[model samples]
Target: DQQVKQNSPSLSVQEGRISILNCDYTNSMFDYFLWYKKYPAEGPTFLISISSIKDKNEDGRFTVFLNKSAKHLSLHIVPSQPGDSAVYFCAALARGYTGNQFYFGTGTSLTVIP
Candidate 1:
């Protein structure tokens, strides 16, 4: 059904802790996965991404792990800071579609307590 789902709508963590966000997808054709972070009124910015062929991808403070066989993925942030408070969206791109059609989960708002 091309639905990407974020099970948790929000998450709260204290500063300097690790924050984990989870996502699931029903579509098996999705070969590309991405995580986007957004502030209050701004648009989402790409954080990390992993191709279906790979199991994990990492940036400076963020890491994304994908389990294609299980149709699951997760984003992890280490040493969460107060600035990390924002909405995170999990996105998936279906293979074989020429146009830019990316499916996004509702989103998970992360609050980093100071």
Candidate 2:
């Protein structure tokens, strides 16, 4: 059972357009949000992240927004480039008594057309 779900399997956008990736979670106990980007044959790399206490976080060209009431989060990449084309995964981190657990979405493949 996936606590996190990515509704869109794929998304395409122009090079100069903004790329918005979305994710939803069923668990309200999660305290952290993380976004990762993966290229073919490579492990997923951390793209950006935000704490549950904050609604928005921005880093360079990437921004992450979290809506606690809706249990939704989104990653925005402004002026998306061809190099930014990759599979994106959003993960929720839950701190439990046993250990920290991470729930990951299925992933959304993003293609930036140049």
Candidate 3:
């Protein structure tokens, strides 16, 4: 089974609203978490991240929250804009078969409408 997952395949929001994306992980050993945004025909771009020790991390209009005990995390985009529409992926770094590696969730596609 995948260590990380994004239950929601897609989401839509109005241009000036808040967009919320959720993610979950099964590994308790994960210490670092990151959110990446991807656009068509290009690689995923790093957005923001938070350490497991921190509950919340924010950058401009983006924020990430983590619940260690629950092994859950969420990304919030405030005042969503049309340019923000894209595939958002959540990733976690944890011990792996050989060494530490990053595991990524499937992804959540967000659409900002006017």
Give stretches of model 1 more than 4 Å off: none
> Against the true structure, what is each candidate's TM-score?
0.94, 0.98, 0.96
Best by TM-score: 2
What C-alpha lDDT values do all the predictions have?
A: 0.94, 0.97, 0.97
User: Model 3: per-residue lDDT, tens digit, 1-114?
Assistant: 999999999999999999999999998989999999999999999999999889999999999999999999999999999999999999999877898899999999999998
- C-alpha RMSD in Å of predicted model 1 compared with the true structure: 1.2
The ten-residue window of minimal lDDT in model 3 covers 94-103
Off by over 4 Å in 3: 96-99
- lDDT for 34 in candidate 3 is 97
Model 1, residue 41: C-alpha shift (Å): 1.2
Kindly list the per-residue Cα lDDT of model 2 for residues 1-114, writing each as its tens digit: 889999999999999999999999999999999999999999999999999999999999999999999999999999899999999999999998999999999999999999
